[model samples]
Target: EMVMPGDNITMEVELIAPIAMEQGLRFAIREGGRTVGAGVVASIIA
Candidate 1:
């Protein structure tokens, strides 16, 4: 995928994991075979 310097980008995600109270789940986003963004899900309950 080719993205311009000022292009607008949107992404969707689906997380399916066994999360406990206050548990942190780590995630990362890759672009051009490299990690560009990363974050942690502080708490998620289902």
Candidate 2:
């Protein structure tokens, strides 16, 4: 559950909103209104 810098891994995430889930989709992980990390959708599970 902990990711270090420059580590590439795939994790299954649950979203609370109906947002677009597709490959190449960019996203950011925020904490305290600041971006902690960022990632892109590589593949969809369903």
lDDT of 2 by residue, 8-43 (tens): 987888888878678999999999999999999988
Cα lDDT tens digits, model 1, 1-46, are: 7665556555445546653434466676688999876656655544
Runs off by more than 4 Å, candidate 2: none
Instruction: For candidate 1, give the lDDT of residue 36.
Output: 73
* Alpha-carbon lDDT, every model: 0.59, 0.88
Q: Pick by lDDT: which candidate is best?
A: 2
RMSD of 2: 1.3
Whole-model lDDT for model 1 versus the true structure? 0.59
Query: In model 1, which regions exceed 4 Å deviation?
Result: 1-23, 43-46
Root-mean-square deviation (CA) per prediction: 5.9, 1.3
Q: What is the lDDT of residue 22 in candidate 2?
A: 82
